[model samples]
Target: MRYLRFTNWLTEIDRMSGPISAIWFEEVRRHAGTDAAHVYGGLMATLTAWAELRGVPCEGVPVGTIKRHATGKGNAPKHAMIEAARARGFDPVDDNEADAIALLLWAIETKGGLA
Candidate 1:
């Protein structure tokens, strides 16, 4: 199977969200500079750089904020977040997708509108 590059995805998003608005990026847990943390942190940095190039404001949202907004608890389990998406009538493909969905809702609700 072929996978899309992160830059490609970001380009698509930049195209869709024209005029460049604020980007609400969710901050994941960084455990003393683990690999996961490094990769995610790098991705976020790249994303922020791209947003900067386009003059888009990027804001980092805490993971706990996403969980609390989506599941009513900051420490909700993965399954609970999935259930929360289901409860909201979303059929998220996986936990990551569910997280994206939750963050999307939070961004829309809290940040007025998307770019």
Candidate 2:
């Protein structure tokens, strides 16, 4: 899928903000050899590159935004999201991936992708 590479790039994307405004884990910085600021910055850079290649606009909401929208709590557990996914009629084998997709669906709904 077109998003496969994008997802990989996201992992390597440098953080653009420090821990203060950063919503992701600090280990993302440590493993990426950059601060949260640089990682987020790199993420934007990668998005720009991908958009140029695809000739389409692609904007991503913050993970926290997705999480809060999906479960009513920003720090909801993976299993909770998986349960939500099941309720929505999608069977996800992996809880974390399920949660992420659930968050994606939540964002889509908020953006009027759903009726």
In terms of lDDT, the best-performing candidate is 1
* TM-score for predicted model 1 compared with the true structure: 0.79
lDDT for model 1: 0.80
Number of the predicted model whose TM-score against the real structure is largest = 1
lDDT of 1 by residue, 20-59 (tens): 5777777766666587677776687788778888887888
Give candidate 1's error at residue 2 in angstroms: 14
Q: Per-residue lDDT of 38-105 in model 2, one digit per residue for the tens?
A: 75666666666655564544555555555566677766687877777787788899887776676567
**Stretches of candidate 2 exceeding 4 Å from the true structure:** 1-44, 112-115
